[model samples]
Target: MTDSNVSFLGRISLAVGTFFSILGDGEFAARVQRLRSGAPVTQAPVAAPAPTPAPQPAAPALKQASPDAALQLLGLLQRDARFIDFVEEDVAGYSDADIGAAARVVHGGCRTVLREHFTIRPVREEAEGSRVTLPEGFDATAVRLTGNVVGKAPFTGSLSHRGWRVDDVRLPKLAASHDASVIAAAEVEL
Candidate 1:
């Protein structure tokens, strides 16, 4: 072979020898080093790394969702009035039972809508707080609920906690302001 070809073969051999040395089995290069009067070298058989148990991936941290998160969710719902449209308020009026059932649907659907919207799913629920106590890390100064849907008398008020559950919705008050009344007058077509 030419000098360049011979040199290339030598480099390939050196690279292969180094790879085996790193894998902790080959010692041919050690003999070559001895012949060249380099420093004596020995490897401690790598000890099979003492079977380090692969570090176990740190067991994946346990994530818990806070109750104040519910408020953020509520904020989103308010921002998107379309979600409220799901509750069907176009009818003339609804009975108390109808209002209660509608409330349950909207309230229960909040969490599911959120999960469908974002990542970072919660593995388990954190301890929920009462309406009086906002969740930790919650900044009231920055939070705002701007969307106000004027619906039938069944969608009003701030979210409130009933026992362990949070109920922030309320029925809309009747159209009985001092200026306006629900009484039949002049047969106005709504």
Candidate 2:
């Protein structure tokens, strides 16, 4: 081989060595070393073995609750508080005072319904805006941490809200004839 050809080949070999070294390919590095030293490159007769497949875990079955129960709850709220009507109403045209007046009535009715049907209490005993420490292994579902959340807790932060939790539910049983899907019945005067 010419001097220029040998030099070019050496440079290519050095480049391949560097690439294989970076990839941590020890076997490839050995082969490259042998090639650079003008040693004969021989392949073994045996073919490469096929990769083994990884074992897959069986998926757990999911439990689904009846939508009728949720519909029944919504129907009861509408009946007792007119909750659906107030929420569905457009308030863009109404003045702030008018809206506030309507909201007061809605709020009173809704509060009455909630008091009668469901027992609710705050999730955290601490007053809102009070500094509190959430110890390690805290319930993630009950308290959500916001802003620069890093490392393991006890996280110290001001309580933005004392979150509500339903301690007990006492919804009345629906009659067999009653349709839960009907949130509110339409009234017509003759």
Candidate 3:
């Protein structure tokens, strides 16, 4: 199973959020680069590889992630919050108040599903904006370095985000006849 302890939905969320973090935060991007190259967390940065005129796409080599959990989670969200509808809607024509109201509904339902299905906790113990120092060899996966990162570790910085980790997942088991692809079945009034 390509599945680690994290659920498919959790990984998806992480990937999307990380994409934005990498783009806006140079320090976060640097840390990701270092980790990708198998460098130690405290090590000085490495020079970027020379770009080739033509680059080829690399095929994924790891075990495949099953879509069952992701579909199930989406079904839950759709059932609870009409999530698919909300996202699919063309909101450019809507007023701010209308959007805010819909967002509240989505947020509440999503929050409920997450809390019920996943035991999530902060990666750091220190309060955000507090000065905290990471000694040599901090867990790179858990705590990503961001903003003005330099030299070795024993690095001190203010916490911008505490970060979240899924401690446990409690998604219900799939039935023998379950169709994972159908995130939500169409309903009609009789």
Query: Which residue pairs collide in model 3, if any?
Result: none
lDDT of 3 by residue, 1-190 (tens): 4566776557669899999899666667888998898987686566675333222235558898888888999988888888988987868799999999999999999999899899999999889999998888777767767654556768788888999999999998989898978988998999
Any runs in candidate 1 off by more than 4 Å, and if so which?
1-82, 86-92, 118-190
Q: Where is model 3 more than 4 Å wrong at Cα?
A: 1-63
TM-scores vs. true structure, each candidate: 0.21, 0.63, 0.69
Order of quality (lDDT): 3, 2, 1
Give the distance in Å from residue 18's predicted Cα in candidate 2 to where it truly belongs. Answer: 51
lDDT assessment of candidate 2: 0.75
Write the number of the candidate with greater lDDT, choosing between 1 and 3. Answer: 3
CA displacement after TM-score superposition, residue 117 of candidate 2 (Å): 0.5
Give lDDT tens digits, candidate 1, residues 75-154. 45644433435433443467878867766766666655554555442222433332232343433233221223222222
